[model samples]
Target: MAKYLRNLTCTALFSMTLPMTAAAEESEVQDMSDPLAVYTQAGLGYTDKGINVKVGQTYDTGSDTSMGMNVLEIKGFAGEALGWNGRGADDSIDSIRFRNFTVDLTNGLGGQVDISWDFDSNQGSASYSFIQALPKMGMFNFYHSLDLG
Candidate 1:
């Protein structure tokens, strides 16, 4: 009876390990020379629970030489689980979405500007808009504008 029990235990253990060994051999393992290749391979099995964002700003007390035009700027950004395929390989992510985003700018001369955008994948919708309120003289007065395209 002792010998029979030992044989049964060995058989059970070998049977369980056979499938695992086969699976490991079937999957190809490639040698990655670049760090980016390793990063994308490892990211395939990753997921996020959620996202958190914190926004802050700093004010400089030091004064700088300027042409006598005052400008105030406000900016913000927020989003969740936006994934990248890394090289257009189509790993798992299908689309991107943004909940809320905004930006505002104001000048000392009572000129103001606002920009906002919202995007979603489920509804297949996206919206982008901006508003400009400038004084009669205009927001900017420049001799030449730079265009890089």
Candidate 2:
């Protein structure tokens, strides 16, 4: 009877050690840099009982930093004004545009501007524009950042 008990204890101990050894061998560390980790968003909103469409995409360059572009469409009593903004490692904004929906609408809007940034101080600035047709108005454009650490 004692010999059988000893054999059972040995078997249980051996089984437990096997799983620990396997887990240690399977452990690994991976890099967080992935260009395909981009994010996208699209939605629709009501403007004085009309429909307003919005779409945007953001790309992360790793190290808690990212860039993005946004396109908005406003349709209602008002026409529409489409705009775009982008950011980089230094948190600087550039290449802004605004235009009228009825005039040369195909080319969209075009403009050039620069945003101030402080890398060491971790601060930046953003801007916005809008278009109005009546009781309905379309305004879009902004920049924001956060610190994960």
Q: Which lDDT values do the candidates have, in the order given? A: 0.26, 0.29
Off by over 4 Å in 1: 1-50, 61-114, 121-149
lDDT of 1 at 116: 26
| lDDT minimum window of 10 residues, candidate 2 | 77-86
The TM-score measured for candidate 1 stands at: 0.15
Off by over 4 Å in 2: 1-38, 60-65, 69-149
lDDT of 1 at 120: 28
Tell me, by TM-score, which candidate is best.
2
TM-score of every prediction relative to native: 0.15, 0.23
Give lDDT tens digits, candidate 2, residues 1-149: 67446545543443231111112233453211211122344444432222334443433334333233333333321112111111112222222222211111222232212233433455655443322212213453322222121
Which predicted model would earn the best lDDT? 2
Model 1 accuracy (lDDT, Cα): 0.26
